[model samples]
Target: MGRHSLPDGSAPASTGSRPGARRRTIAISTGLVLAVAAGSVVALRSDLLPFGEPCDGQSVRLDVAASPDIAPALDAVAKTAREGAARTDGRCLDVKITPRPAHEIADAFGQRPVDPEFQVWIPDSSLWVDRVDAGSGTPLTTAGTIASSPIALGAVPEAAKALGWPKKTYTWTELTEAATTDDALRLGVADPARSATGLLALARINAANAKDTKDGDEADTRTAAAAKLLYQRVADGDGQVLATLPRDDSGAEQGNPRRNQALLLSEQAAYAHNTGEDGGPDLDLFYPQNGTAQLDYPYTLVDDDETTPAQTRAANRFLTLLSEPGGQRALRRHGFRTDNGRPDSEVVDAAGGREPQPYSADPADPPSVKELQALLGMWTVTVQSARITTVVDASASMANPVPDRGGQSRMDLAKNSLLQALATFTPEDEIGLWKFATYLDGNKDHVELSPTNRLGDRDKDGTTHRDALAAAFGSLAPVPGGATGLYDTTLAAYEKACGAYASGKFNALVIVTDGANDDSSGIGLDSLVGKLEKLADPKRPVPLIAIAIGAQADKSALDRIAAPTGGSAHRVDDPSQIHQVILKAIMAAGSKGPR
Candidate 1:
């Protein structure tokens, strides 16, 4: 997926004598003779041999799929192992290293059919391992971590000086704000959807802001603001983002709009750039004072039916070899920290680290899966303009008071939550509103309160579309003697969304209800689901995100109808949680690629 490509051959070598076969043969024979002369007959045993005997049995060959950044170093160690005839259970070990982007491999594993060509996976971070585990894929056994690299902000000398780097230490928030708010320091980042380095850094920033704020909403607002700023200068992936930096040490090139002054990257990446022969300006690294997220390269074993006992043992042996001092030194030479989390001063210095920087400080705790998902959700929404048609239940039961919201009715809380959620969207996003209840409109169960339009669009009165939507949301009230008409309203909204599908935009229908479908005269559940299934198109998807409010809501029915449209159903005990659930659902739907 990047500059690194697979080796000349895609398959592992056959089990046999290797290039140094003659030398191994000589050594093995001499060792046996020496043992015999010493009168230690038992030393001739394969297990007891001081130096392992040449493989009398078949060699155990393993294909290793490693992250691109670490593949070259691993290949070196593997080559050494091959020349030295590394062995497990008297059999020689042969490992072939292939450099692959972790995200591509993760997507492969996420699909059906539990089959993988490689026996071992060494992604740059354990986050990929977690992603695989979260999906329905072949199980992975993580033996241990092999290397580590901390995420940091890297800036050219000129930009670093502007931020008072090397002498002034700033927390994640302070550092990000200082860099992003300045026109002179244009910050760039790899898309969080693609780069762990970017996502982890953003999560760290969120966590740091959360500690300084009073609640989750405030923290989310601050993080979203930062995300919007970053989206303006985002790149697709690590390699592409790095390519955005100035090509030379000239001020003219540095001021180019296409070149980035600063970027979020791993320490090892910075080191590589500084030490490369490209003749570009070296970056000055800043390890946030709040702590940095680390890329813990976990050595995971792919346990599938194709795996053999010998291969398993060989995988374990290779892991042991990687943890040895020789392997650690090799990794350090490649600008990575060993598994013990100790920073190499040489590498740090080469990466532009100085005394005031917290390069050697303990890594920040890894973000939880949920936290990462939420961050991704926010990123997805912030980066892409959405076209959403939201339908809220206007049944009489909505007048029921919420338990702990200072006697606010369910309708009040729901409207307020929707307004709060609306604030998260940008002016480019298109949104509309509908209120539904049986017979709310003449011979219909749903009525559009606001027509879908870009939030920035202005009417004859000079009122923005966003203002109109907000006013409509505020005017929402339960219809007198109205009954739930979930089935009819959902179908109508979904059909409208699909018919007006905004190509290249995140188009979807959001239905929020506090009760089950009560309009029996409308389309049956089976009929509605069938129509949805027929309308669902992979090329023009319109996922129906259904949110059930309170204990009285029918989540099962919502789930059934949602599933056919590549959507999902969620339940919230409190209406105030609708905003969060909506974002999470958007994340989930957006991630289901091509479906």
Candidate 2:
């Protein structure tokens, strides 16, 4: 994601031996000779003299913004450097370490034309660096990583015993299921939107679920279910999630409904809590059999034209000091892995990790930007209620049979996918249905079959809105001799969705079609797109999520139509993938705010 690659798990190489007394004397003699030859009236500063000279009054001060979890350790290292009078290019180093959350710093840097107050940054993961680089802001020069910690599930002693933490090694999927399905476990996680530890852990869980299941729908279902469960007990960040744990070691406190018995946490965090003087219950860590995601504290330089050469050298010098023996010892004492990411047995034992657990396993690959965005989007929609109006094409070609779906028609697969997607929505969400075919509505290309209403609402016949929508989805059939009216249907659906925009809900339009527009008499493509652009309002965004279903579908046209509303278009070769596409599209759009 950036120009600098992550550390390759190798120990830091030696920079070379210090200058000997003879070498220092020769350097001093040489400096005096040069000064005499120059015949200058100005007196030289002490720092310009020799290697062992005392620092002058002008010390280079560098402000460092470090993630809270690692700040104290870095502070200790800074203190040692200050006391030792660490110097770079003959100038004394005065480094100030500030404890700030990684997300807060990332947000600040993500803005345009960032003028960061700090000269250096050490976020919990390189993911934050990627985020800042993705934005239109001042670029960062990554020096390297300082420390690392793998993400794991932390459970109280009682809960750990129940799950057989040390003896039973479970994959991420199995661990998630055990935590979410058992009422006694009371699992919680830091909000993915705020915590890298939380987001990375969730991504690993999703990847594990996908790998274990052959059926895409089943995988999606499992992932969504786990997200919902975690959402119900989500904390604001790593610190907050740990605070949700039982305060005391008593069995009664462990069973408290208001407290969480297990949480998604980093090994360092668990170690801090377990060894803190606060006298709280200790946490036993579970390293997933599948590879663990790690928090690699990357040391990044905030580079700009305003930065002085002295400050740059000072920053690089500080990074070098951090990888040295003294700095490594300090990091280990604070419960962090060294830059190489190799597990230290003492640190692992303190964090409640045991042998046979995959604590030393290689770190999982970092999630891509697209994957992270989609995961956040899904988390947002799953936690928040949505108001979606889905429109389906009922053109004559919809009856075309899928290649490997046991003779099932495209319509059949589409309907089944829609129903599966419907189940993921909460009752608080609002949903509606529409079917479109040329001349099917006696002049209009699309007709509304169900009004957008809360899924929990019931009619006089005691039928829930969810039930009605499901029935409507199942009833969708191809109109005999009908043609695709994609352009007109899209315009009409978007207009209606915009008009009935639900405040504080993920209000949007979803369109599913298997072919390009075949009705030339209907509105033209350019005209439809122009109308949608005119109607689209950023304040009340009703993004148009278009899904093109077969080889005959026009993805390019759909993309143009979707662009105006800040929505996206997706094409799937098999109709059975419509549900996954819809979920991913929803995630992509939802991450862009209300849309």
Model 1's number of clashes is: 0
Clashing pairs in 2: none
lDDT of 2 at 100: 90
lDDT of 1 at 145: 70
Candidate 1 residue lDDT tens string, 356-392: 7988888877887677877887777777889999999
Candidate 2 lands at a TM-score of: 0.83
lDDT at residue 439 of model 1 (Cα atoms): 93
Q: Which runs of model 1 end up more than 4 angstroms from their true locations? A: 1-59, 88-92, 399-409, 460-462, 537-540, 570-577, 587-595
Q: How many Å off is the CA of 230 in candidate 1?
A: 1.3
